[model samples]
Target: MSLTFDGTVLVPVADPDDGERTAAALAPYLSPSSTVLVVNVIEKAGGAPDKASVEQREEYAREIFERARGPLAERAGSVETAVLFGTDVVETIFEAAVDRNADAVVFEPREGRRFVELLTGDVARRLVKEARVPVVALPEDDG
Candidate 1:
């Protein structure tokens, strides 16, 4: 029997593997009722001398989301992307998912753009900690 999934899926993606793996895990389970919502949060205040202010952070997030559309869609079918400002990645994901009435969250277990710098602790875990909705976390194969 097929799982009766309703509403959108919240995918907190930072890289291609996150997108791809989320797609892979979701492929077998997803039905026509499923939709993917990708939330890419680019941290605003870096240790850099020039830290992004509130507006700048939001703008940067928007830009990142815009640039990522084609790539994400290629992996997970149609997706709605959003860039949000704040250090609380957990809160951001929770708010976005709940706001959109997402049935669950499918995500990758990594962060950052490069191989070595990726943060091992994923935002999805935080979602699991904070939100009651189901969160599916996928790790990319080393191969």
Candidate 2:
């Protein structure tokens, strides 16, 4: 079945390049009124880990949003950005979608082998199955 993307689109971005990839994937489906919300979730850990501070993560998120905005500005009505802290990534994304009144949720699958997916449990797969709103997953670009 064919789908049309309008209104607000909630996009959860993990990697820096995910912004560009997601923008490219969703550009075709977007309309003049479409608003893309690029979200970066800092997976919260109980103890201190070898990761950037919250401020640093927020800065990185902004950078990702800036990169995405350049490509999507011409295609979509507007592009927004957010930085969230959560323990459960999927749940956080879904919550954001609901809060933002998103028409759809778009994301890219984590690039890895089947063994890795099996070990970590694919977040994209779980999101597709559990999301209340329409979910769009861009195919992994290995090249």
In the range 1-143, model 2's lDDT, one tens digit per residue, is 65657789998887668787877777777788889899988888757583778888888888888877776888888888888788788888999999889988898776788888777668878899998898988766656
Poorest 10 consecutive residues of model 1 by lDDT? 115-124
Best-fitting candidate, scored by lDDT:
2
The digit string of per-residue lDDT tens for model 1 on 12-72 reads 7665444455555555555555577777765544455536566775665565556545444
TM-score of each: 0.61, 0.87
lDDT of each: 0.62, 0.82
Instruction: List candidate 2 stretches off by more than 4 Å.
Output: 47-50, 139-143
